[model samples]
Target: MLRRLFGDWRPTVLDVLLSLAVGTAGLVESFGRQGSQPGQIGDPVPMAAGAVVAGTMLLLRRRFPVTLLLALIAVGLAVRAVSGGGYYAAWHFYSTLILVHTVASSTEPRSRRGFAGLACVLAAYAFVQTFQHNDVAELMIGAVFVGVAYGSGILLRRQMDQTLRLAERATRLEVEREARARRAVAEERARIARELHDIVSHNVSVMTLHTGGVRMRLGDEHARERDMLLGVEQAGREAVEELRLMLGVLRGTGAPGSGALQPGLDQLDELVTHVREAGLDVRLRIAGEPRPLPPGLGLSAYRVIQEALTNVLKHAHATGADVVITYGRTGLDVEITDDGTGGGPDGPGSDGHGFDGHGSDGHGSDGHGLIGMRERAAMHGGELSAGSVPGGGYGVVARFPLEAPVGVR
Candidate 1:
């Protein structure tokens, strides 16, 4: 309640009206109680009239402060007239005090300064009248009124300046908060876009290429080729299922259900079989017993193997490859090496340094593909390294922490 009264526009307006009313009431009482005797007091009618006129002027002060000041001056003069030079002539100064307040609050600084000068002139005139009538007490009261009104105006001006500065600071803080929120939302959208391109584009392209190969081989009508076509069909179906699971993760549908099996370290045999059928001999070896891994690590492991084999087909042109998996107390390690000579002179089949800078499209994996692999490994608290093997072959080595592997196990 106090905040509403002191901090808002309505409260200021009410304050102005209340101060004017109090000043008017004081004037009225002073007028009506005048003694009307020589050097004793005078009639009350003049004071009452002055109070009414000043109060009426105050009603329009916010809109016309100059007019209100003029009206206050005229009322003070008329009150003195009815008093026959014996009334407490300074009573009207209370109304002048209120006029100063209204003018200071409502008018421009220059206009308010002009009103202050006018008030000083009026105070001097009242001082002359008091000296003429020999009323020392009324003269002192009038002088105090003039001093207080001027002081109050100065204080109110400082308060208004402070209020404006505080409001500007609040507006600036709000703008910065809104800008930060907008930037966070934009960054989230960009991340989603990158994920969609990485997941959907890579999966769909692989499916399309394998499908075309199956069609071409079916046209040949060989029994062994027919078996390869069947294998391709099975692989394509599994790819579709994997794509659906990834899409579910993106859409906030939660991880794939227990019924959906995603390839992990245990599925290395199947991965090698698929690559071999694709005309690359990939041998799989597991050095230690497999343990259940967190879903993200399993998925990352699957994708790394898939990308490595894809690179063998697209860049190696190798007839065979070796895949070695090792389980340790701290983590799992995977290494894929292919004896394909499809990359350039310094390709993955050259010296060990060849594939270091081949993450770009120069290798089978595009720049984004390697970035996706790195991100996946990091997600599982792991690391992945790719380079040429000791011989003329490409090698990819990955290690996922055993204690933790992306999200809750």
Candidate 2:
């Protein structure tokens, strides 16, 4: 109930009510004690009534600060005129101070000059009243009221300006935070794209090659189709597993203490076997004894090899390819090159390279293979290169530094 009646919005409501009630009672008391003496009624009715009106007007001071101030000044003048300076009619000085405070605190700096002019007029009137009555104490008291009210208004305005500045700063920070979140979301989507490309292309190319070989060996169409279907099924299942693993990481649902689904340098042997079984002659050579590598480095290495082998199967049509892993003291180096089958599917639409090597096919050179490989390598601050060897077929080479265990560098 108290808050409803006396909130920040209507600060002067209670003041207006109390002041008018008390002043009106005082006016009645003074009227009952009246006794005329020339221009003086031996009563305080006029003085009390002027106070009630002036205090009531305080309620509108904030809404119409200038107009209320003028009304307050008029009331002061009326009280002085009627009482001829008697019965503490000088208390209107308090109301004048209140008006000055409202003007100083509420009005903008440009309008404050007008308020200052009014304040000067009020000060002069107050000074003249005190001077005429020869009241030094009243004069000093009035001066202090003006000084304190004016000083407090200046300080209050400064506080308001500070609050506005802080609010603007908070707004700017919120905007920047939203922008960063959007950027993070976009980056995550791009990472997912690269992952899908790597998984789909590598698995599908393997399935295709195996299915083709099964057809040639077994002239029985049903048998060939069944084997091809099985290969497709297995590849798809593997792709799904990898995809689920990656999604688990993305969703922060990975096993406790586990991070991203990054199949690294150690998985090269299994990867090689999958291709060899798909009817390719794959020779694996490990130079400079194997060593542990960072998770991102290992994943990049694996993806580079996967893309290279997929390219060979699709474009070179080669029965053979070479997988060489050199583990240097500083970093890991991987090279995959395929001997092309004489004039097989070397033309465009065969591989992302498109034989003419100008990326002629609707499917450009940055095939799923190149794009995935590039993303993997760049993820680890590494570089990947791919192009046809000078004489015959295609080659993919990638190098990534393995400086630490597993974390962002």
Candidate 3:
């Protein structure tokens, strides 16, 4: 046990320290024995030698417990035979007790028969030593020492097993929680896809068909009106294509390699560049020590930034924008503020997204883009708020937790 401490193949510090302590105690007991004590071995040489052997033997207790106990018993008897009196070193006696307890606590000695034999021999050794002195106190104390050591070892084993069981149960519960969360997210995505496909897509398709039919019926004399109708028809087709892409993402069938389909914060620079080229002066600032986020979580944050920037370009008529990402203690915060419009979805320069009638602040627009952004935030147990900033500008802010909740709740 004293060879080393705390390496892969070395004994622990406790083991090494305990062995050293026991060995040191044995040495003191052997040399410091009283000359007047009744039945205590008088000769110091053989008893001291026996003490040292018993002390060293403790090092092997964990690996060869049976052999150690047997060796101690033999050394104790041999010391008795060599000495003038019938007694042996008292330090060896206490050292044997420690080894007995160690063997009882561990599971390496699997044979019950072997353990029973060891217990019998231990009891016999105790009785023989105590018999030398007819005092009732000596006999009782000796027996109590052996019993307590064995009982303590049994208790330790039970405690170790209970701790392991609790750790395993906690791991199982964590796995189940994650699985349930993913399942809920998938189910909600599927439902949204279904609504878009059945109702929204169908309505858009009918409007496009009617527009095409009307444009065809128009006469060549109405040239201006025909060109206007042609523009509407083209816009409707583009909207359908955009809807198809959104549906593909919701249904988990979007091509992974498509840049617009899957985006994480790692590609933030590209997004910033795109917004810059769109004629909106964009300033991207990040605060705090940024850490890697979960893939799905990063993607969600990217989408939020994308949507906010899109709104600023299409609705806010903003000439410049500020995007601030703060990696906070509990989670992350994304804020986008535009210099132009100072209202919500239905405010100045708004495209009528139909948000205010739903009890939103300054929102009564006939659009779903901002609503989709809010839904995305909520899916990750996050919140999104959009309105005018303190000054003469509009802002969108989203907050998401690092260790997010299991589901939307």
Return the top candidate by TM-score.
3
> What local lDDT score does residue 165 receive in model 2, on the 0 to 100 scale?
96
Candidate achieving higher lDDT, 1 or 2: 2
Q: Rate the local accuracy (lDDT) of all candidates.
A: 0.62, 0.63, 0.68
Q: How do the residues 1-409 of candidate 3 rate in per-residue lDDT, one tens digit apiece?
A: 5445423444557667667877677667767774657755477778777777777777667766656777777777777777767665567767777766776777423568446635744754574564276587977777688778766766776788789899999999989856754554455455434443544555576788899889999999988888998888888888888877776766565423222334578899999998899898999999986888865667668877887786677666678999999987778899988887434457555533222222111222124455655666786799999877777777888998886334523
Model 3 scores a C-alpha lDDT of 0.68
Better of 1 and 3 by lDDT: 3
* Comparison by TM-score, 1 against 2, better one: 2
Name the Cα RMSD for model 1: 17.6
| Ordered list by TM-score, greatest first | 3, 2, 1
1-409: candidate 1 lDDT, tens digit per residue: 9665335434357556755775567565764456645654456655666666666655555555556567666666666766656444444555566666656655445675566655644654463455355477866766676667756775786788889999999999999757754554443333333344344545555776776576665655476776776677677667766765665555454422232344556676777787788788778888886777755577677777776776676566687888888877678887888886655434443433233223322223322444555666776779998876676777888888887434535
- On the 0 to 100 scale, the lDDT of residue 143 in model 1 is 64
Stretches of candidate 1 off by over 4 Å are 1-32, 39-41, 89-91, 108-144, 221-409
Q: How far is candidate 3 from the true structure (C-alpha RMSD, Å)?
A: 16.0
